[model samples]
Target: MEHRQLVHFLAVLDSGSLTAAAQRVGLTQQALSKSLSRLENELGGKLFERGTRGMTATRLGESISEYARDIIASAGKLRHTASAALGLERGRLVVGLSPISAASLLGKRLTQFAQNYPNVRIDVEGGIDRDFVAALHRGELDIALSSQVGGQYDGILLEQVFSEPWGVGGCVNNQALQDAQSISDLADGKWIIGRNTDLLDDIIAETFSNAGLPMPKPGIMTTSVLFSLHALSQSDFLAILPQSLCRDFNGILWRDLSDGAWISPIYMMRRRRAHMDELVSVLLRELKG
Candidate 1:
């Protein structure tokens, strides 16, 4: 029930052992045990089952984690709200992104945000959409940018950033492409696909299938955006990229699919709020601006 106990609970869950969690929380082994015991007594159940290797969350502990994180996040938000009322102008925001999407939100905008709100702390982590969405539900991330999303997330909302279709692209100076007038001409070329999920593979399959061609076996499956972009520009892989990038992204040139355009949208994601927080609003504005 106590905030510290919940914090300790999560520490143990994340760290996977009492000794490690105790060390992390700056508590002696005995003190951490007592804290855990007090929390178990309050909740009327054993939260974790201690084992020789480490501690494992009992069913109760596993289930209570989301509620614990929500309570902690709410409490932190309340503190921030009070601070804002006192004109403190201090805040923390966490953002999640896939590497390529950073181009949309980082650079000048990120630098400007840091300069204008030096008191605000920002944490940006790179990951795929599903991981980011789970983090959002756990109160880990403030916002995210993603290319593809599906299924239901309980408290998150998505906003499309663009509706433009991505184009197939190859090295601007690839010798093989000089005689090519359509995607079919490069059907045998090695392609780049996403690594974190099968979504990109499926998209490739569908795009080729729609064009009445067998899918090109992926040459490189990667999550590193820079590598993918570099490979595309440097004559190593054909890729579907942002429309702007397809035309010219450091030597990548757009090539027609010759069947139809392949649309890959970019979206911004955040938690749904009845009343938006001031700092979050500012952050969103900077990202979209």
Candidate 2:
């Protein structure tokens, strides 16, 4: 229950032995063992099983270890938050971003935000749209910039910031892509596709299905914008990318879908009840601007 006890337990779990944990924590082995014993007494359970190789956590220990880690992390965050609130000039912001949006927009805004809020530490995680949305709901992220995939969340608020047009991109000189106009025209061409649940992939799949074409054979599937671009640049495969992504790539040629517009509506989403701190607000404003 005590912070020191939790720390000792976590050290043992991580180091896999009381001797190593003691050395890491700068305590004698006896002291570390006493601390573990006290913690076990307080919790009424054995935390570890000793073996010739190392210590292993029991089921209850494994469950509590996760909680202990979270508790320690949350406590540190709270201390940092309190310091910032009291004008101590120290804070942290965790922002989640979709990979494509990170490459296209969030990366720049993040740099500017860091320059503006020099005292605030920023951590960024990039993934597909669904993972970003799920992180927002789990309170793991302060804010996120992602393409809208499904309906708005009841507990989260989203503000539309921008709409980016999507286009098919391929090697600039791909001979197989000559005179391609519609989605079906590229059906037989090798395709680099985004993963399922990715906003761009969902849109591309729907467009192809609506055109009564079989889904293009996926030569590569990726969540990384850079990887997707790299694959397109190296091979004769085509990929759907944001207009902004292909604008500066002379090695790539973009062709708009002929049937309908494929636009990804980008949103800045955060939990509805969560307080928007100054740093988060500044980042959001910079993104919107």
Instruction: Return the top candidate by TM-score.
Output: 1
Name the runs in model 1 displaced over 4 angstroms.
1-56, 86-90, 105-111, 115-119, 163-165, 195-207, 230-235, 243-260, 273-275
Candidate number with greatest lDDT: 2
Q: Each prediction's Cα RMSD?
A: 5.8, 7.6
Task: In model 2, state the lDDT of residue 67.
Answer: 84
Q: Candidate 2, residues 1-289: lDDT per residue as tens digits?
A: 6877887888788778888778756799999989999999998999999999899998878989868866665655564466458552567888877755665665677888788768878888765455555455445677777774566676778888777777788888886565886777776788787753355566776787888987787788876777877778778989877777887766888878744467777777777766665556666778887
TM-score of 1: 0.68
> Per-residue alpha-carbon lDDT of model 1 for 181-263, expressed as tens digits?
66677767788865422454566567667767987667888766568778877765776665544544578776555444455
lDDT of 1 at 66: 83
Q: Write down the TM-score of every candidate.
A: 0.68, 0.64
Model 1 lDDT, residue 41, Cα:
99
Give the range where candidate 1 is weakest over 10 consecutive residues by summed lDDT: 193-202
